[model samples]
Target: MARKSGSSGEKTRAMVEEAATRLIARHGFAAVSMRQIAREVGVQAGALYLYTPDKQSLLKDIMRGHLQHLLESWAAQAPDPDLPAAARLERFVRFHIDYHILRAEKVFISYMELRNLDCDNFAEIERLRRSYEHILEEILISGAAEGVFHHTDTRLTTLAMIAMMTGVSTWYRDDGRLPPDAITTRYVDMAFRLAGGEPLAEAAE
Candidate 1:
């Protein structure tokens, strides 16, 4: 089993990582430092080490947490004996956009600070990310076989869709424009269009 940190240790780690994620997203990882995160977390510089052994370690943990949360969300959203893959595809795509929008900070941080992750850490994150992509790709392929959707390259489309959803986290500000659900719905519409699926209301017409 993974060794868990004490409550205080977990809380401090959360604060520091939250600060790091915000600063790293706003200012590139190259521009942020452990000292800066420590200051933002209201802790002495050296104290940051109590949670993370080092800067590289801290970055790895943050990324791991992001991926872990993602895996959990997928597990929740994907039903057992699920509906048709096309329907599931819509849920997956829409849910992803909603998740990233709701947790924009984590999404932004994952996008920007990925360069900071060491080779092994980066590989693991990519592995989990690809698992998500594969799910979408499989659904699209199934839809293609059923003649309900068309795609020349399932991999390319899946990556493109993920990129589109991630981009939402970059620009979506809760106070700036639409609510998260509306934003997600619009994105789902756009994704359907890109995947060659007509919007439901339009299909009915």
Candidate 2:
């Protein structure tokens, strides 16, 4: 793992988290051991406890980091705040496909390991995710009001969009025939077509 600039404490914690992410993705959370992760980071197994008091805390750290990125990435690149609802929704589809859905392993880890989080940690992660989804849901509803998007259950549409984006992780492979850009483009096209909100050509997959 690459090193980052931080206090010794922070650096160790970062390495610990990254090691766990790689392990959990290659093997489920249940299959991973603190000793294994410590070995990956070239540290004593007991040393990991200094970073995260328990395995559950380590899991929470992983979930929190992933969810924070998910929310922040969407917030950062979202379309113009004042744009028509459908336009915002269209932008969101493109961003989701290109950014969050593009990386297969990271996406896989985010979805599969989330259930491993403790209840309080899981709820916190869910709150962040819920906020992110609510933004898209509002855009869909607004698009419907503006007579640009097909009227449907916004909740269902939002959930479907998330499911579709998350599903890409399952099938997407680095050595796949298509490059990331091409893959995102194809998925963006598919998403709009399925959403019943025909996309502008540039936005089309």
Candidate 3:
């Protein structure tokens, strides 16, 4: 059968994506089924096909959508390209921590479920992932050129910085010892130090 018509179909499609994101994050992709996702969305199994042809496609959509939206969101709020590398680096660190901290589920699945993605899907996702990584790598490179950051390996440092920041999602809680702003500030200071830039004198506070 064909998909539902109009706004209702779009709404269901959003519901499908949301339910799949939640369930896949909780159970892992291979363990999730269309029927389970549909149940989570309060829909019948067949209704799922109306939104996504199959599980693989749905998984692809979920991962791809997440990355695409990430790129777009960053683009929307990305600091001016002409900003000093240190300023850019600080902004990037703060943006990354804030973004991933709030979407821990998506962050978890994006990394954990890579093995389940087919070659083509995996490649595309990797490309997107690399693109996101490059944003920081470029800042590292520029800062190095400007003598603001001293790093022999921008790629290695970029990956390490991202891992450090994204790790906040794994352990941070809203009611934890510090609020999000405090976490962002601390991570920003750490990122500067990691990149071989000096931290603000007051940042240690």
Q: Which candidate is the best by lDDT?
A: 3
Which pairs of residues collide in model 3?
A: none
- Residue 138, candidate 3: how far off, in angstroms? 0.7
What is candidate 3's lDDT per residue for 59-176, written digit by digit as tens? 8888898898888888989999899998888889888988899899989988898989999999999999999999999899989989989987888999999999999999999889
Off by over 4 Å in 2: 1-5, 203-205
lDDT of each: 0.77, 0.76, 0.88
What does the lDDT read for residue 99 in candidate 3?
87
- Give candidate 1's error at residue 186 in angstroms: 2.5
- CA shift of 48, model 3, Å: 0.9
Candidate 3 ranges beyond 4 A from true positions: 1-6
Total clashing pairs for each candidate: 0, 0, 0
Ranking of all predicted structures according to TM-score, beginning with the best and ending with the worst: 3, 2, 1
Better of 2 and 3 by TM-score: 3
Q: Compute the lDDT of residue 147 as modeled in candidate 2.
A: 76
> Which pairs of residues clash in candidate 2, taking residues 3 or more apart in a chain or in different chains?
none
User: 1-205, model 2: which lDDT tens digit per residue?
Assistant: 2234478888878888888988988988899999999999999999888888887788777777776776777777877878987667667776776666455666676677787877888888789779878987888777777777784677888898878876776777779899877777676766666567777687553
Which ten residues in a row are the worst by lDDT in model 2? 1-10
Give the range where candidate 3 is weakest over 10 consecutive residues by summed lDDT: 1-10
lDDT agreement of model 3 with the native: 0.88
TM-score of each: 0.85, 0.87, 0.94
What TM-score does structure 2 among the candidates reach? 0.87
**RMSD per model, one decimal:** 3.0, 2.7, 3.3
- The predicted structure with the larger TM-score, 1 or 3, is 3
